[model samples]
Target: MAKYSDEFKLMIVKEYLGGPLGYSLLSRKYGIPDGSIIKKWVNAYKAFGKEGLSKKRSKKVYTVQFKLNVLNFMKQTGASYQETAIEFQMNEPSLIAKWNITFIKEGIEGLKEKTKGRPSMSGKRKPKQSKQEKVISREEQLEHENELLRLENAYLKKLKAFQDNPNAYLEKHKQRWHLNSKKKDLN
Candidate 1:
């Protein structure tokens, strides 16, 4: 882990931004550790000018509401990570990217910064569903399965009939397809 001074980072980032050759060439020419660092620095510079490439301050935890607001704004304007970072006064644009990913994956609840590692099971909680609800759900599932089975049976019977009389089935299907296509054209 190498620490790049603000001046050194600004120099490299400026050089990269000024020229066409990207991080790979910059890394080769300057021997500045990883190419990815240059890429990140370039992105930071593009997103937040001089302030973005500076050494980050002490980590400040953001509230869930703030995160939600940031995401909402991003959604409304169709903003990119860098744009959102600039608008929200964030150092690293990747933070907004992470927030968006978390929101899309686990929803608003995911915006909350939870304790890292295994969650404690010590808190007592009520069961999510009671017996009556469970029974109704089971019944609904069974009904769905029964309906599917009936449809499958019907399909198989029709398929067998078609197989037994291919010419007749084909003629009937051609007529049906023409009728459906004509109806679509009229609509």
Candidate 2:
């Protein structure tokens, strides 16, 4: 579909408001395919006056009041963007982008429009730990295991000496000993 400028739209609305031009003449004048649009604009002007035609027919912008309402809903209810959008019958993506920025800088009050084209709400997280990271993690685990084994070996040697010679075991020793003698069969 083609987009028309607001000026072009206002011209069409003006023509419609002026008099009956039938569907064919109106279609030719505006280069719009359907007569229905002209009829609708006429009806809208009749019911709503010039205010109806003033709005640019495109992606709608939320008013500041509306944005504040949405923000208040978010802060008070702690609703997710999806929930707030759904509750208010708003565009989820647009509402979410606004909600995020609002929460970031000015808290709830900042939900009002800054400039449009804020980035998407859900973006991909950074690439998870690379293969190199995984390999290093495994290496660290192995080193830890080796250290544990060294400590265990030293403990067992001291315990064995204590059991072998009780008198020597009673003398003051630099290192305290722990014996896990349940594994005696392994020795």
What lDDT does the true structure give each of the candidates?
Answer: 0.86, 0.67
lDDT score, candidate 1: 0.86
Model 1 misplacement above 4 A: 1-3, 17-23, 32-39, 46-49, 116-187
Q: Candidate 1 versus the native: TM-score?
A: 0.51
Best candidate (score: TM-score): 1
Instruction: Give the alpha carbon lDDT tens digit for every residue of 1-187 in model 2.
Output: 5665557666787776676778668888768988866665555455556554455447677766777777778779998665676567553334466556766788645655567587676888778988666755768889989999999999999899989996777763523332334356458
Tens-place lDDT per residue, model 1, 94-156, is: 788898898899998998878889967877876688755665576888998999999999999
The positional error of residue 129 in candidate 1, measured at the CA in angstroms, is 22
Worst 10 residues of 2 by lDDT: 174-183
TM-scores for every candidate against the unseen true structure: 0.51, 0.31
